[model samples]
Target: MVAKKREWRSGRRSVATKLVQMTRHLVVCEGTETEPRYFGGMKDALGPANGRKIAVVVRGSGRHTLDLFEHAEELCRIAPDPYNHVWLIFDKDDFPSNEFDLVERKCGEVSSSSCTFHALYSNPCFEIWPLLHLRYTTAPMDASSCQKGLVDALKREFNVEYRKNMDGLFSLVDSRRQDAISNVDKLDKHHKSIGNDRPSTMNPSTRVGDIFEELGPYLDKGD
Candidate 1:
């Protein structure tokens, strides 16, 4: 028996709806000034394709390690969909080591199935990231020493004094950003080699370069 073919109405064709996916990053930092400025520069410098595809939004949470982590986690839970990358950029600056460990563990536990938290922590101080752009340093410093070193490095390299905030700080360091990333890798490796991989103990290590690499395509190539 031959089956009859169904008749087509006209020449019209059906099309499937396409869902566009956009990548957005929500950043919460412990600093009130510089972190926002730095990430803002990155967002502003995004190239066209990246600007359309990704977003790097930063907020200053003014919280310590665990508090900052919780703030980022809370924001991730409340933010609308497509804001999947939630990062807490905090320093281990004299905060209790237990708090640092707790923050790290909580951030680690968040899976990507839902919005997740990224702990972009710098041991000692956040200023260590900019200092890495100037030179390779594996020196273990306390918060005071870290601040002093950063101030001296900034003065020597860029002729700018270390203020609590610097306007366009990321752009200032953009030319040598790759160098910073490389140096940070070396620092991280050094820490791991010495078995100081944990947060409070990873003195002089910064996760800033890792975050920068994630958002690099969005930023313009600066000379």
Candidate 2:
């Protein structure tokens, strides 16, 4: 006897065809704040051009790189459906001295076979946004020092109280990111105990298909 082919049903349509038709696209930011600071407000900035919705998911603040890795497979499953076009942004301090590789590995591990990945790097963390702002704007300010220029710009753009608040918040949040790295000793112990990488929920080679395999019934059935 011939094995029956699995068929999915949608209203008056085959679900498998709809799934195949879905456009896969996304702009995934490493940290929560970088996207808003850079691309969120700018309409048509890096527009998909393929008529796909622009979805942005934060991997948490700069501190959540490892956490993001742990949940990478889950993230791929949760991403916008169908088509797979993604841009993964990373900060220079992601793995202290290896941000590029970290971002690359993460994207590779979680991305579907249909998805394409782009990795962009920013140095010293989300401070990349501030650096970019300084590079393009002078207003009689010095661009020789990106950090100093950013500080000066922040001081001038906002009132004294707001400036202080911004600095304090940025520093406080950034410290948490720094702490995430500093706490690696504990992570090492946890990894050794589990006989696997610590803090990350899945191995670096885990694929999006692994997670979606569990969602076979719930997924849309269309091309």
Top candidate by TM-score = 1
lDDT of each: 0.79, 0.39
Each candidate structure's count of clashing pairs: 1, 17
lDDT of 2: 0.39
lDDT of 1 by residue, 1-223 (tens): 9965544455443655576677788888898888898887777777564546776678987888878877777777677665767778888877889998678688878756756667788888888888888888888888778778878888898898887677878888888988988898888789889899687888888887777656775564431
What TM-score do all the candidates reach, one by one?
A: 0.86, 0.41
lDDT of 2 by residue, 117-186 (tens): 5444443344424433223331222113444655665566443222211324333232232233333333
* Off by more than 4 A, model 2: 1-24, 43-63, 69-72, 98-100, 105-113, 136-146, 153-223
Model 2 lDDT at residue 143: 19
